[model samples]
Target chain A: MPLLKDNDFIDDTWQRLDDGAAIPATGDILVSLARLLADFGKLSNRDGRLGVEFPNEERPGVLESFLPDLSLIALTFPKFADGRAYSQARQLRQLGYDGELRAIGDVLPDQLSFMLETGFDAFEVTERFPEEAWEQAASSISLTYQSAAYQPRRLHVWRLRWARDEGV
Target chain B: MYRYDEFDHRFVSERVAQFRDQAARRLSGELTEDEFKPLRLMNGLYLQLHAYMLRVAIPYGTLSGKQMRKLADVADKYDRGYGHFTTRQNIQYNWIKLEETADLLQELSEVEMHAIQTSGNCIRNVTTDHWAGAAADELADPRPVAELLRQWSTLHPEFSFLPRKFKIAVTGAPNDRAAVKVHDIGLRMHQNDAGERGWEVIVGGGLGRTPLIGYTVREFLPETQLLSYLEAIMRVYNLHGRRDNKYKARIKILVHELGEENFRAEVEAEFARQKELDVEVESRELERISNYFAEPAFETLPRLSTGYEAARAGDPAFAQWVRSNIAAHRKDGYAIVNISLKPEGGIPGDATSEQMRTVADLAERFSVEEIRVSHHQNLVLPHVKLDDLHEVWKVLAANGLASANIGKAGDIIACPGLDYCTLATARSIPIAQTISRRFADLNRQHEIGPLRINISGCINACGHHHVAHIGILGLEKKGVEYYQITLGGSSATDASIGTILGPGFSGDKVPDAIETIVNTYLNLRQGGDDSFLDVVRRLGHQPFKEALYAPA
Candidate 1:
């Protein structure tokens, strides 16, 4: 798997710990919600990037009470048609989670722009796709219609129309 | 009509290019049929029973003469000579090739139209009253609001992959001509105590297998807060709407399960939060859109034209058309003329390229160069002068576009059933054609009075069977087409789902069953003003059901 951030593939240093898997005592690690809850004390004291993996069904409001200290939150796509993760990502942004948001599992190149708009800063992608494919997908539609929750620099047509008139 | 701005044009063209890329990928085997199916569907291409059917959105059912001509060209050049105008106020080409769809969309974009969100589990086209601006009974033109919705919901990021498709309808008038109560979100514009107009938003009403009349969520939503309120509804649905069962996944089911009170509370909470977001299109932007749909220029004339009166007295056929098809317009000397696509015994909304071209030409000449597609599967010339009606009628008569069955039994609304739709179990078009042919006599049609006979091939109710006065639903039993009857449904100001009459009938026997019901209503009527629907309301379903099943 490859980790893509800011339209570029960067070396992934984060380790994913599945349920019942022991968290490594040293480097940055991401753990599922169950694992995090089970070993909350031991993992928080390790001081690497504190990341929590969230299933799509879990409301982002769950983190508003606990995740102020968290460095990253990764949400799962699970399937292409299962878009609960997209809503989750937007809701996470709305809850003022300034931490890096990552989309993992079944996230396709086609959905990268949508993911980007909805506040996913990083993606765990299949290594088969080149970095260029991801970049092209991100820039596929140079402008969009609706303003998204996380995209601070909105490129909606209404804004673009005013910008055009100002430029002329 | 609302013209696409530079940004709108660019957005559509870019979308076209992107779809073209996806089509190429599908051809090259990079995308499987499973993967490509939804992508194609979002662009309004459906794989039906026979071939690919492409549905093109006529935003708010409004189109210019030029766009209608382009639609005619697409039907002539790419499709079989005719196109079906759908009950959503959109057009569908029955026979389309999967490969040609991208190019077809490109052609559509040139006319300020695209197929975006016509299908798929997203917010579909925002339909409005067909007699939007010109109707004498309207307070405001709903098309501009509908157009703003179209822009906002198009390729919407979060709501695109919803659990099930969402529909929104707007009616500017108090009469409910747009069938607002039957959509997922129905917006009715009305005045408040202070005399300021706003929307009375209705939620959760839909008729597929399960019929529901929407309940009001907001009594008076301010006009500027429309987008924020809609976003609140969509976000709530997108987040918590059930994905477990595809059948129970529409926002309606969620609204049903949560109870209307709880649902409205949840929606209000979301709306309170979303109101702070700057995601809504600016009011100035809405005003810019409103300017496009402002009243068109009209020639000064008396309320009644002597020329129209003379023409009506002179030609009985023209008189029949004028009486049934022409409705009072807001402007003096102008009438909103409904051009029935339902010619006697013809496919309910099928119009040939020649007929469409003639409509376009006639609209250019007499109708302020604008036309509207009706949810009743008819075309409307909204601004024709009373003096020019006879001339317009002549052109329409010559082109087979003059059907005087605007609200008559012959003007049946039928979904493309087993003939085209893969989801359909039996045929609806043939049933509609047969019933229409049976009541082809103009005098008999007038005598029986206003009756709406809607037929659906399957339970999906694309034919709006649940909301018809005489609803016929077709089911397949032992490889034979069976028709079930429902009575007394109305999609007007008083919206109610029809009741099931009795046992199912064969395809051949369904027309006679309808005839029997009409005759029963005629015999049971109290007076001349009593409509078929009104009579059914008075007498209930016993007489009609008994007559339908009686010894024949």
Candidate 2:
């Protein structure tokens, strides 16, 4: 799977581990939530940076205590139409998670803009679409009306219009 | 009445470009129908029974003369020379082609309008009272906040794919002309004891397969905190609303399942959290938006127009029109003129391109270049002078726009049904037409008094059958169409879902059944002042049910 980040395909360094797999010695690793919960003490003691594949159904607040030790959190989109992960991503970002928020599974080019706005910094993509498609999708809309996770500092249109009127 | 500024123009243009790309991709077979359905719906395009239908949003039902003319042009160029004004105060062209939709949208954009969020699971076009600024009893104008909500909900990233579609309605008056009580979220303006006007927020009220009246979540929410509060409600619903069954996915279901108290607590918690994020727009921005809706200049004139009175006395037809269609205006010299789209035996809300153009001309000449599409599927000249009413009526009558049945029995609300909608189980327009023709006599309509007969082809209640005083729902049982009747429903401040009356009737029998119900009301009422709805509510559904079900 190709990993998209910052409008380009990037090499993924994180290794996904299945349940009951032998622990890798020294590389950054991603495991499912159940694995992390079941093996929290051992996973925390590992030298590799930790990441978890959070299910969209679970609330993001459950991962609050684990945030200090985690470097990445991958949210699943079982289907593109199911939008629970967008809310989870925003909640995770609001809970002060500064890690790389990765979107995995069923991701498509058209959803890139929304995923980016909702604070997904990385996406696991299949080869169905090209890099240019993703790039175009993310940058297609030049303006947005509401504040979002990716652009918290970006002012809403009303404020921008007011500032422009005042010649600020 | 609110013109788009530079920012709004740019935003809509960009959205059009985005949709153009999406449409191109779908045409190229890069996107499947499942993926493209939602995208097209977000832009207000639907694959109806025969052809593609495009619903154009007239935000808060407000349009300028230029906008109305453009709609006429769109109908002439892209559709079958007509458009249907919907129950949501939007207009739908039923004969659209998918390939020409982008161009149609492009044309719409030039007039500061687009079909954004008119359909889809996100927040739909925010509706307000059609007589917002012109109504005599209004506390304030609700369009400013409605426009603000329009901007906020447009392409909202998190909410675009909610459990199901959401609708919001606002009203600035105690009398709920906007039908606020039946929407997913209803905002009614309220003044505190200190005369500080705020919002009374009602959540989870919706009319569909499961008709439910919303619960009041907040008695008086300060005006400035509206956006944040609504965000709270949306977030709570997005996270908790059921997705397993599309029928059970509205916020009303969540409110009902979790109980109103629990839903309110969840929303309050989320609202507090949202407040901490400081996402609410500044009060100055609201003030700026409100300035656009400020009252138009009116020339001071006497309370009575002698010319209008004389015209009324001389022409009985004109007098009847004035008595039925004209409403009191907030300004002394002006009156609100309702142009009924429901003519005798005519389709309920369909207006020809020529009619649209004539209305555009009339609006520019008489109504300060403003027009309103009412939820009752009628057009309103919100600010016509008393002296100009006669001339306006003449033009309207010439164009077949004048019908003295604004609130009368002939003014029926009907959905496209089997004629244009794929979801309809039976045809609604013909039934509505038959009923209108049955009550074609103006004297009979006036004698019957104010009544609302809403017809829906399916249980989705697109025609608002659940809220009508006399409701008709058409269903197909084993290849034959049958209609069920209900009574005493209202979409007003005193909102209630109608109770099913009795066994269904055949398509040909529905109009007679309706007449029987009306005659029963006439016989039972104590005086002329008693309305059909008042009579139904006071006497309950037994009398009407007995009349319809008794084998006579």
Candidate 3:
């Protein structure tokens, strides 16, 4: 139950709203995509900001029109071996959504750095690891073969040694 | 062999450190088995029937004498004193310990070898024709491009979590030594009519339950546009491949469901969209990779070596070995030798540490210190002088490796069945051993002529049974192991899946059934040089089928 963002555990302001619960007046709340789709009219009128949590099967294309109104999008990995969420995260980021991208559920320290490189800026981890663990996982290797999705790309170590995209 | 540069060395070392931490966490109970399984699998460690099996990658199946010796050292030091070569041109140690897996990987890294991506639901090792550079018939060396793809796909940020395991094979020759047609993605280097060289991309060929030959998606992908085109294919597969069922998750299944036209359209669209990504390998970088594959200095000698010819005439066994194992090299006075692991009544592809060191020493002295592991689970000294072959043959014979059964009925390709693999339903090695012993006579094997018998304990096709001349699939029926026979399958330029013969035989009856099929073919044969596959093709499996079920 730790929310790690950018190598640091930060205070989570968003509350996960369950079904049949009264909508809060002015706080950021995360809801399932099914919930948002079913009651978008009633939910959009609330005073609080909106965050959508995508179950593994929900297609991101359905959220095209709702992208502008969202502040946080959580890609859920029900289990560690289920990697449909990784592809889902990359697709969402590719559509020019600059909002906070977080990976929730079944997060392990070993996959933390890969999740980071694939454009997930935040992770809701079940087991808390030391700050040094995250630091080491995030920067274990300085070089990356593919360019990252996040802006100001920090994936390539060869760029530091040579010109950008230049062959050695 | 591509020597690891500083960047590659750092990447492997860092990966080892990372795995060491993960292993420690697993031991300390910080990570459960569920969480640790995929991590271990990605590093090529699998918990099998008895112990942890470590599969190490021999990139494109090319290794130096030094690397081969290091591998022999690992086999002697870590697990048992031997290793099993796999159909993917990899070597697996069957008795690895969980605690020493990371340390063993460190030892492998020191030899420019690591077990990265040998397993797991990711891109497996990139394999090419074992006779890649030395073959006279190939258009170009496939290893440089293969090495480039290996580096690009290693730890690829986006496509690592594919729905299922992916395999890609490349071949520079038109003969298809790498079984390119049965791979998920097959790249064939060909030159167009205008003399412009490029790749002919094939998609969706596989050999599991539903075997299908790959369809050509691109008639000619420019050599420079190779990576971008591959990116296009991977992107399409990642986005659209089936995720609901593990059996239907392979790219081959998606390609099958979409049909070739629709699949080609989608891949072309992705290729067009990513055209501006600038992901193609730079020419200089390609040159750097190609530099490592440059042809070694071969001695210029007469076309016919009197010494080699005299030795062959004097020794009948060595002459038979030469007839079966030696392939013509492009260079004069040089021949490519296939050191068969399938000796009479021995486990196919299993080599002892002493055999490995013998090969290493022979390669250093006679074959320019380069060795290649074939997808058939055979080893090749790609460039050996004709005069020195007698010496090489003597060394191999002393080590019991001069089987002289390459591409013959005795050259069986089999997987580690119930003995070592947890996924097997029956024992395949014993069956293979029995068949090998039955057909142990070299003259008889040569008489049979170019027959390929592949055996798998299950339908997973790890033994490539679906693509063999005589394919055997073992299954369990009511607590008894039953073997099904198939015929007419070929994994070549003309790739086709075999047809299952009616009914199944028990383990004891399987070898006799195969012999009956072979005898039937030999009786109905038209010519002495006609292969078993040729006869099977001319007359359908009905002949072999009727012969198998004949009374008595």
Candidate 4:
């Protein structure tokens, strides 16, 4: 396996799962808790994109040590009841893991823009669903909350700056 | 209210067409759920506990009577004949189906409203003082600037993917009715010694798991460069804001981590780099936006009406309502009336379809066919003639909106918690109802003075419980509902976060705890003039803490 930056078709050591597909485990492939719980620091290699899934908890853990070698991180919504993924996705972006962050598992069409804001790029298009939905979901919204992985210079922040107090 | 100009009209129509295409593709199975989640959220559609919830922007809390009527029609036709107004001056319809969202949006568009950027982590609906242009103490009308920002931030290309959702609030008055301190960016319109109106900019104030009061980043920003300076601050946040941790992703956290000096420097550097873009307000464009907000035609009516005074003296209930709900207007013979949505034991901001229609009709008949929804969850008729107030009161009394509890303790601010919102951990509205019922006596409420009781389902603080004079946060411990009480929070000019008192209580016992806190405040206060917030601020949280946790 090699870094596939050339946009050429190359196979990495990790096994690829289609959208809505159950997580597959291999000694080399990275997996998110969307299907099964896998430890981040304990993972053997960072060559593959690792999936990140959230379970309901009052407070989630911080990602201090895992940012060094993370290649691709995917967030999953087990169900709409669980919004821990929304927080996790933002935490990943804040931790400065400049990698392809994707959203997988029970991710509905309405949440694409919000997922993207917390810094998701690639979405896992499942075999159970049609591919056309992907384009529609991503383009449904034209505005965003802040300037993130995609948009870097936002103007709305200026005009709307009335007497708001953001936390320091 | 801003009617879309050619550019705005074109932009929304195109955006609608784009969404229609996306819906078509989703129907054709081209867009998958994983691929479309962000898209739907950006448009204010959320998958909730029971169904999809659609939040629609009410833009600066201003709407025409026709617009209000259309919203009523939407509620009756699409939703369950009621709509819930949120803390951000938006409305949420809880029962919207995913499939019917596009059609619903089309209906909103027909009424000159849309749910654009209402949800997504994007620039949300711009909010301002509910009293806005009509407030007696306003330095200048802030709506034109808010409208300018609304146009500039809408579908802006570079800022579409922020680390988290961002909110901005503006106010023209020194009283700070908009709670600008709790927003991602807060701007206060100020005038220098030269009488030139500019802005004092603040940033990084938000409420969630972490509650922060925004700090001033700029002492004064010239009105001309307001937009450019804002861009600079945002660009700094965009480049340096944390991306690895969700909790630490809000701009407030970044500002905190970087320190104000460093953050200010970074913004200055970025602003210096972008100076050549010439993003300042164009003279013609500024004039054009301001022209639409020019003062409404005023008749040379008497400043104080003897007729109104006579009526106020005659009707005691009307006098109480006038004292509680009426506000001074910029123009003589005109006053702003705040119609309380927190009617007795009903849901705080929920208005039934018929109530909406009736309010709309009243606005048309008495006011200038205009209504404003305050962030405090009340409707404002901004241009009512003092002489016509009694008649307006009669109409409102006939309708169910005639609650004289505008700024009173019973005028509770509540979020639709577990009963409606999927994000809520416990029920908020029911608790509010319980408290309102417990203190049902208006005489008792008036004696209590101006006390704010805000409730949130979770720490997300949508109900702004963190800043309430008496705050209640609903949390779930195991299978049961637990309520956490906080005291001394205020969102006015003197804003401060509330301090939590001891452990969480069961649902039924929560109201009793509130009663104790209020009684304690009453016992400790020096006089009637001192409000709940003032007494709490003057005397630390010791008395409140003692009263709330006194033995068994």
TM-score of chain B of each: 0.99, 0.99, 0.99, 0.98
TM-score of chain A of each: 0.88, 0.94, 0.89, 0.57
- Clash pairs, candidate 3, are none
Q: In terms of lDDT, which candidate is strongest?
A: 2
Pairs that collide, model 1: none
Better of 1 and 2 by TM-score: 2
What would the C-alpha RMSD of candidate 2 be, to one decimal place?
Answer: 1.4
TM-score of candidate 3 against the unseen true structure: 0.94
Q: Which candidate order results from sorting by TM-score in descending order? A: 2, 1, 3, 4
Chain A TM-score, structure 4: 0.57
- Report the CA-based lDDT of candidate 1 relative to the real structure: 0.88
lDDT of 1 by residue, A95-145 (tens): 778888998988888778878878889999987667877887777677776
lDDT (Cα atoms) of all candidates against the true structure: 0.88, 0.90, 0.87, 0.75
lDDT of 1 by residue, B20-89 (tens): 9888888999878887888899999998878888999999899999999999999987899889999999
Best by DockQ: 2
lDDT of 4 by residue, B1-552 (tens): 567644455446656777776667667776776556666777888888898888999988899899999889989988999998878888889898767778888877877788888987667998999999889999988888887777666754435556677788999999899888888999998889998888989898988889999999898988777777877776566555766787888999999999989988877865665443334423334666788888888778889999999999999999989988999998999999999998889899999999889889878988888899988888889899999999999988988888888889889999889997878889999999999999888888888889899999988889999999889999998878899988888888778899887798999998898998899889988899988888888898888778887787
Ranking by DockQ: 2, 1, 3, 4
The lDDT-based order of candidates, best leading, equals 2, 1, 3, 4
Which TM-score value belongs to model 4?
0.79
lDDT score of residue B497 within candidate 1:
99
What tens digits encode model 2's per-residue C-alpha lDDT throughout B242-305? 9899999999999999998999998998787663333344566677888998889988989999
For all predictions in the order shown, the interface RMSD in Å is: 1.6, 1.7, 2.6, 9.6
- Model 4 chain B poorest 10 in a row by lDDT: B275-284
Query: Per-residue error at A135 for model 1, in Å?
Result: 2.1
